[model samples]
Target: MRPVSVRYDNSSVRVCMKKKAMCKIGLAVMLLLTPMMGWSAKRLNIVIIVGDDWGGPYASAYTGIYGRNLPSNVVKTPNVDRIAQNGVLFKNAYVNAPSCTPSRSSIFTGRYFFNTGGGAVLGGTWDFTIPSFPLLLLDAGYHIGLTSKGWSPGTPRNAPFGGTAHYYQYFGTSVSSFSKSVTKWTAKGMPFEKAKQTMLDQVRGNFEAFLADRKPDQPFFYWFGPTNTHRTWVKGSGKALWGIEPDSLKDQLPVYLPNNPEVREDMADYLGEIQALDAYIGVLLKKLEEIGELDNTIIVATGDNGPGGFPRGKWNLYDFGVATPLVVWYPHSTGGRVVTDFTTLMDLAPTFLEVAGVAIPPKTDGRSLLNILTSPLSGQVDPQRTFAITGEERHNAKARDDSLPYPARALRTARYLYIRNFAPDRWPMGCPYVAAHVPYVFHDIGEPSPTYDWIITNRSIPSAADYFTWAFAKRPAEELYDAHKDPGQINNVADDPMYADIKKSLAEKLLAELKKAGDPRVIGDGGTFDRPPYTDLKTVACQDTIPLNWAPGSHH
Candidate 1:
């Protein structure tokens, strides 16, 4: 297999795109006037703001109009929703995988999670063979920079996101631990509002510094990733900071989650973190506006994935786990349009390249969305944009006894959601216990929170029992759900005779697609990912090279 086309998915694309950009672009830089009315920037800038564990339906942009009864209506995301109002809001956007490393891997390489080899799982290293789009953009003479968490849980040897060359984080990244840091600040008699802003100022300061360092008329690509929306948020922060009452989410929760106070309050705190993320987004938006570059830049905002430490979220293949809120505000594009096209976060790579006039590298799976964004019409602009293929291999490597991955792939279509769990006997989430108490006993769901702890200790309670099984129990070999009928994805119809035909069709489609993508799981022995460096959970990444026997990109 010789790791087919490692160039485009990793560092090679950097070399190739740089040549293309150099040939096409002139050496001279053009200056934009400072004033808003007369600002004359030469090229479009790219700004991608990623939220940690943020989901699609959380924004008011999505829930404000529809899903009005949903829990997201408890909080308002004016800044994030503003991007929707000013541009196109994606109705369905998913990550290739749920875990942070793998999802970010897919987004970076514009390929399926499996194609990234060791990059396909958490605690996995960067497959240097995979080309990062941001690196390509940087190579093509785009002034690029990154702030906050870019790629995580693994050290990218090739410095996938430019290895701190364009990195700018002078103030601090304390905003990631939003509640904890804010608590520390406020505990010292700092005002709550000031304490919160004290953390958010890091976001503002770092972005401004990146902007300041950029050359005039140099089309820039900046990534702002904040993990505040992740777990370990302040319990009462929802009500105290954002005025969201936990009881307000009483009846709005999905059927998978208990509507009890402890659960509601925990979720409310998560929402508060989302609100905090929205505020940071507001800071970025304001900075762009101040520089008269708000409309000049192609602003894309989304989370790496959905919520963590929640039922059927993050580590699961469910929609809440994979689906991300995609809002793109292009300067000359139509606004207020909800595009229902099935798009993955991977698509942003090609979209950025196409807009920047940089040639997209070969062997990339992402299709450019420039056409859809530039179009005035909405809803299914591309008929070929029908479905998304999402899956997960491993979260915490030692999740299972042998460090085996719970390999699963899914085909999410317009009306149906079908999944095939290859390792059905193993826990889809991490194991109930681990070799050591590193990521806690329940490694995957180890983040300490009310809902997580409560579910663990009170799994036998009648009110919490069903959710426990729904969230943690090992899944069957196949699972099918009627998305139209059960939006929460609670009902599994894979075994139901009524859905027999549907299940068969979906399973076949998923397998064929995985095979075409050269997924190691569906090809040959399907044991490549099951072995080391992916299963080498002891280190942040594997030190040894992927042996020849563990061919990653083998194809038919």
Candidate 2:
């Protein structure tokens, strides 16, 4: 084509004018695209789903061995499995503490359980004031909404952030508050309908509503912590409700029972709850997809602690207790990848902030795994990030044999697990074993069932003793296990002659991490817990094991 030669007058001027026009166009394009890129990097919609008192075996990624090898008996966590399948599934993940409130507090604050100073479960209003993870996200321009249990049974009103997440819904049917709710089912039966209603009516429904209510702000962070599969078992009519049968699930037999029928049934009911929770999670996932946020959203699904009330499950420093499943899904990036790194609950807050392109506060101890998710094949992780440490303060005090307090700390890695018991002689379960007429916590153990009866009747037998004796048994300053060889963590190989070198190395590593994490209970120094008359093991005397037929809300 013949072009018109119109720029012959003032040739230098024309050249300069052309260069200026190109510069202006470049600047305009940059101005427009820069914001879009920044928005993409900064805009993150996060959903964290924490299962109540669950462990790694419940999730399908880790061999799906909750109680047995039966596939039909396993927990059907399709939504949770979806997270693992879509993102990086951390095969070796752990909670900083094995107990409820303490683990959650550590997770939120990115602090060790010892520093939190509240113990395993919250006792009262004074116990609530710990730092929160959501508050930090809120400060970083996130619209935070919590469905069901967020930061705790009690609020962290006194911590630096000082305020709680916008708790849109409280899940489960329990409404006695976090403290009394523990005692609500002191009798033999399941929890009151109020407890179940709270979950069905409020927690699940509220989560759906919360999803529907989002306005697409700068970014949104939602905590969808559920109360599914916690306790007070419910069995649906003929078919099992939650894709599990308690008796059919695998039972680890916590140092107490040797594969008994009664215990199997109880375990089945627990699995039912897990299955039911899984279905609800599926609902949430469907909602996310329906709202067109599924592809861009980051979904983290895991458990708060281990199984409740079993030996070395919920309250102890064993892998069976502190080890949990961590499934992170970033549908837009790496999907269907499995990561074998050992991660911690404390890592959550920092990771959330890091993914959103926000500055991580110096006070936090957790390191972000965003890079790992974004570049799964590169293995991008801090070389220095090694181990996760967890601590415990108390369990159901009213449910112990000797009435002694249990205090412990632990460190875990891909290969090893180390436990340091501060109160070595104390019972992991509460000492006195309260025998109140009302539904007492430990009275459930005193029931006439075969396993319970065997445990109470044969306290003299080492294997048949209650959890108090099992927990109160002799312990070393350090106990280590090679998790690769011993996933169940039954054999105590800390003193084995063959693994002496490994033990020494793990001990040194544990001390270094504890010190780095600001744990005061290093070596024998005993952290700052010098409060006089710390919880006691004073026993309450009673006549016989409480009856199992006690009515709801009645004396045991």
Candidate 3:
């Protein structure tokens, strides 16, 4: 029994004189480090929880062709289906640019949202020489932070995650304005479920102030980016705050959106802001099961794009505008499983640097799913994880005209989706009127509710003229689809003729994945994303009015 040496640090250094010799050196360092602790592998702790116009094949956990024609889920999200019943749910995820600052700058630089030059589109310009897996897990020491919208309406210039000094926002982003700050904190009298429980206690007081300001055992990486499911809510707050019955979502619409009752009460108020972000993700999964760090944390819910005032969902790449809503969760892996892997939130910055062992940055175009999340072989586990490749140069750099960037690119596979409209003579949505950034007329379809006033007052009525030419037409620079027979991509069988050899073999496999990712829009007369720091509309500045003070009565 020669195991009782004496020394215990607890929270600092303690040479161990007494206190029962520091409790027999914490019982001889737990019997000599409990069997090499899996070769010292406790780095995990990442979190993510993204969400912002969070899309998915409208969730029934997307079975068969990923929620084929909206499989189910009117909106329950038991804590986002209990983090997909404790992890791994991505029925084919995506988002290599659907909008929100180049789909969160391709999940903060796993790369390929057009290689994120000017953070590649939609108010772009955060390209601080790209390389930010949360600032490389805050330079490998970890303990990163971020609350509302992280790689945001870009132009931040630097600090991919350590900028606003590791940003927490005591409680500002006002829980991303859920129901307009709970209808202005229930009009100041404050009791509408106590002003929505103070915006879900501002998402559990900003992740308990970034886990009580990390330091001990460090290793964090939060991000929690909420956005109230991105868009102007409150038009009958999905049956007034989540009863969610716009006629029970009119048989789960989606035939190229244009169903009735004001677009089924705006798709039941965007599924009541995703059931108020699943009750703020069950208050961050009961604060990581009461701070024990819920099995050393990995979590990851997801979504950075899709469904913002519908119609080919947010800034279109289609597949419901790069549908996302992955899942993940960790610790022993494989629970309630389902992976079908062809993911891309730029494979989550090399899957958070291969589960924090970190180093995967040789111009990463995303790959480390860490053996398809510790594989248990769920359908399509990895077989080179098939294809994903989405793109869109500009979302609203004034849609077009002197700013022009509706350039496009896409490739999704597992039975094709292929598109390539690199400016099919422009106007794919923008300039028939409002050409300086959204104010009516095809502003890249979103944010004008009642499905943009029932397709702009039924554009000449003929059965709403094919729902206003499938939400503002302008195409034909190739577009194939057999995505297992057009999974609501609204049929664009390219130039038919027996799929012309499947559209010249998926346009040479999307131009060899944009010339193997040099992608200055196909690297030739691609016009380097067509001019000036990709049409540098003055590095998209101007943002001031931020006085929410966490809104509930907003401190008078």
Candidate 4:
């Protein structure tokens, strides 16, 4: 018919032109859509804040044993509270390991520490090949950047023990104080005022510069790691920030120690460090809002490991050492939902990708909490998602009296915790003479905190035995606790007949999980590496014989 009308009117010519123009526009739209693939939807921005060696329930709002003593206003963390108020707070969050490098490895790769080459802590020449959260985001056309530690010091760049660093090249790196301190143990203990000022100045400048320089066109993934909550007693620092004197903090002790006044004072300094860390977080949040990026950004705050100490925590399998605070705030998820399900730091990598709407690699051991964030009706994680496992190989050996370390693993569920100690005869805390760890265990023990003095002096008293055992006892093959009744894990129930079923069930599960992840201790019938090697071995070793690796780098 149109051919017959070849003698077209001017109107027909106009119609033809309009149709051709529409076709061109459609083609262009399709071409543009092609690059979008499945991520055409709005992308989510991510920011992670990691507190060094912070513990769970430290914030004032929680009623757990850890926070029971904090006055509503004792630790003024309005900003941290704001995050919890706006988003969900995970009540049972944990690290795969209680030590730094291993916990961080879990956070980065979304795999169990046993699965990672770093068997326990930063040593073990940890493998970095496992994919990281930031790396996943970067691959998805998002701008990835980190201001603090990404993949760290003890991790090597090879085989099962070594892996890849996703953020090394993709993200622009800022000199991080925490990472630097980890690299080389300098400035054992900076004066409180100087340390606080130094940290504030460096962190502020770094954050401001980061926000100022980020690429606007792409969504960003930024991590700000602060070195405050980790140790090396800085006096008077807590008073200036939290308005709490060292004595007041000592009075609010989480653990009672009859012997060490200096150790108690040191606890005050540690609490002060937490306060300072909280303050910097406030600063970072304000800066983000100033840059007009706070709302759309998803913020995650947690610790790299548990509190750095001896006995009941730190290199051991106890709530005080491995359990940590995990607060997440997303535009869609911030509604104060409290999740009691067990979750590990390893889940962080997958969670980051899922938030950004990226494909999660099958190799990842973590599952996204995004579904829980978006669906409040879904109240709990799956029942199978009931356990958390952690281990230890070596920390700063130079910092311990025992230069050669022990290997250990733990399995924790809602009510029960089972720890399998491979070398019960080995010292749990480093030896008193190994230079790297000597000062922290010996000189520093009586100087800053009572807990240390109490631990060392009362190892012989039967009533105080568990308390001391929590800190330094060599153990049997296994230790078990009913976390519901004993969150402190003061008693060993593994040998008790009453917990026979629990012990058997927990031990079995632990074995399965560990075997699945290929842990050497499990596979080799309980053998351990002598000590993980470090890049700065000689330098770190020279510092203390029991050298400390707590100082943040000068630039960070």
My TM-score estimates for the predictions, one after another, are 0.89, 0.75, 0.34, 0.76
Highest lDDT scorer: 1
Worst 10 residues of 2 by lDDT: 1-10
Model 1, 1-556: lDDT tens per residue?
Answer: 0111113544542244457665223221111211211114266889998888898458877784444377767778899889988899988889889888888888887888888777788867777766788876665566788888788877753257866777888989898888878877888899998987787789899998998887776678899888888877888888877788999998788788878888899888888888888889899899988989887899988988778888888888898888888899999778999998999988888888777655566677889998899999988999999999999888876667677788999999989999889989777766655332243335576465567666656666687788878888878999999988888898998899999998899898989988988999989999888888778634332112112232112210
Model 1 scores worst on lDDT over the 10 consecutive residues at 30-39
Clashing pairs in 1: 9-130, 9-131, 10-130, 10-131
| Candidate that beats the other on TM-score, 1 or 3, i.e. the better one | 1
Candidate 3: give its CA RMSD in angstroms: 22.1
Q: What is the lDDT of residue 11 in candidate 4?
A: 24
For every candidate structure, what is the RMSD over all alpha carbons to the true structure, in angstroms?
Answer: 8.5, 12.1, 22.1, 12.0
lDDT of 2: 0.57
lDDT of each: 0.78, 0.57, 0.72, 0.60
Off by over 4 Å in 3: 1-49, 52-177, 188-197, 204-206, 213-217, 223-227, 230-232, 236-305, 314-320, 323-343, 349-351, 358-449, 452-460, 468-493, 496-502, 507-556
**What TM value does model 2 have?**
0.75
lDDT winner between candidates 3 and 4: 3
Model 2: how far residue 200 lies from native, Å? 6.5
lDDT, candidate 2, 224-275, per-residue tens: 6666555544433112333344445444434333456555665655555555
RMSD of 1: 8.5
Better of 1 and 3 by lDDT: 1
Write candidate 3's Cα lDDT for 26-71 as tens digits: 5565456434322135577888787887885554455344544452
What is the Cα-based lDDT of residue 437 in candidate 2?
66
lDDT of 4 by residue, 333-354 (tens): 6377777767888887778766
